[model samples]
Target: MPPSSALRRFFVCPSHRAFTLVELLAVIAIIAILAALLIPVAGAMRKKARETRCLSNLKNAGMAFFNYQAENRDRFPPACERSTGSWRAFDTLLGYTDATAELLHCPLDEIPRVRSLRPRSYAMNDPLWQRESWPGVSLNDMDNPSRTILLSEWFVDGNTTGSESYCDLGNPGTFAHANGTAGNVLWYDGHVSQLSSASHDTNQQYYNFR
Candidate 1:
């Protein structure tokens, strides 16, 4: 049998095992502080992720536009054009994929009801292209794809008059308030990007490259 001293040592906990209440509280307080510091960062990260996803949605929509153009002899949809009574162009592409909503919308929008139907956070600038002096102006005529605003978030109405009606070709930006400063924009070349508050003007300039 082991000695009594050995048995006692084996059963007894070390002094380190017993933390004081103050020490335990201090550790918990530090953890709480760390969590508080990370909460905003985590939220920002989540927002960025959502923005990336929205951009991907725009890319898909851009592809859908190209496909539609291919099928329709290079003719693009009207900026405010709908199938008699429907959402914007994004709705027309719903048959292709499920990410159509992200192309039309941002994660920061407040109107849940609006998003629930078409799930879009952005609109197309087809109306601006409609005013072109020549026929079949085409998206390629733009000086720079990065500077152009092909897709954006704008106000939706019961009558379906989109904000793109106010936009213009070669000058692709709008003062629409449907989405906040940190909104997603899809370029003409099927690429999506994020626009910042300081990047674009009140009208979201054409060549400003927001």
Candidate 2:
């Protein structure tokens, strides 16, 4: 048995004392502040992650275009050359890439213009409308392949007619992400980049293929 003094000291130890209400409230307040600070940060992180994923998907789509070009005599598939059913332009890349159909979808895509039957979230630049010079013009004819837009994160309509019908990112909602403005561009040279939406003019040299 311990001495009475030792028992009293043990029972009354400050370290073992219960927390005061004020202390508890302070701790809770600190936690609440931390959560308040972290929530938006966490959301921003998630949005950035989805943006990265969307870029990766565009990269895969670029690969598919390259592969399609390799087999199609260096010519890109027609954006809307099809005279038939409800096929979107990206469908022209389906079998060319080993990536599943999921690669064609952007994680940030919410306002899809077309049905999910073919599951596409990117739209091709339409050179076919201006001079009927899209799939007809081979990649060899491109002046600056690195700058020429091939595909972008946007909504697609039918087998053709996407993004802007001209590759202009001037619209407010043209290249929208889940949160705000974002434009993920896949160039003709098989590279992916985040481009400024308002930075491009429809007739900019970068948009010119010839």
Candidate 3:
């Protein structure tokens, strides 16, 4: 071959190298492994973000609660009335505390499914309000406000018989976050913190009505 032609052919590169079947398969396998590893990490990061947002929402709700009490003679809001489904006393604080209704929602909550029934994510501690046998307690009634849980993330279902629209934190099964193992609990003292399932199960007194 002419030197010039050889040089031109080499420079132009009429043909190209292609990946071998094994090499291609190996590349695909590597990609699959990387995706598998990254997927869980990404999911965990998203969950953490949602948890942080939910905590912030709880903090806003806690402030609303305090603001409501400041105007209402140091009393907490009434629980949802089971008979007429009249009004969720907590919802009444929306205007009083300069809080929007959206602030009551946890980002992790299943919005579409529960929006019609329980539009908000946080719930009131039902035991804080007087019922038949349950004695109503005020914010002042709490001896250890720092240790008590005032509000938390709750899952509400209105389809069930005798179901109320509002979340009643009096239930032991009530969760604070999406994991169902831990919750973002708002204390009467206006501090919000994460309460693990283990801690909640061990200490029922903090959640109970005084």
Best by lDDT: 2
Assess candidate 2 and give its lDDT: 0.65
Per-candidate Cα lDDT values, in order, are: 0.56, 0.65, 0.64
Instruction: Write candidate 3's Cα lDDT for 1-210 as tens digits.
Output: 567976887888577889899999999999999999999999999988988888888887777767777777777667666664433666576766665777877777763433334456666655565443343357768777777667766444555332332443333225455357777778778898877766654235334445
Using TM-score as the measure, the top candidate is 2
Screening candidate 2 with a backbone cut-off below 3 angstroms (N, C-alpha, C), the clashing residue pairs are 87-159
> What is the alpha-carbon lDDT for the whole of candidate 3?
0.64
Superpose all Cα atoms of candidate 2 onto the true structure and report the RMSD in Å to 1 decimal.
5.2
Give a tens-digit lDDT track for model 1, residues 132-171.
3334336556666556777665443333344343322222
Candidate 2 lDDT at 142 equals 82
Count of clashing residue pairs in every prediction: 10, 1, 1
Worst 10-residue lDDT window for candidate 2 reads 164-173
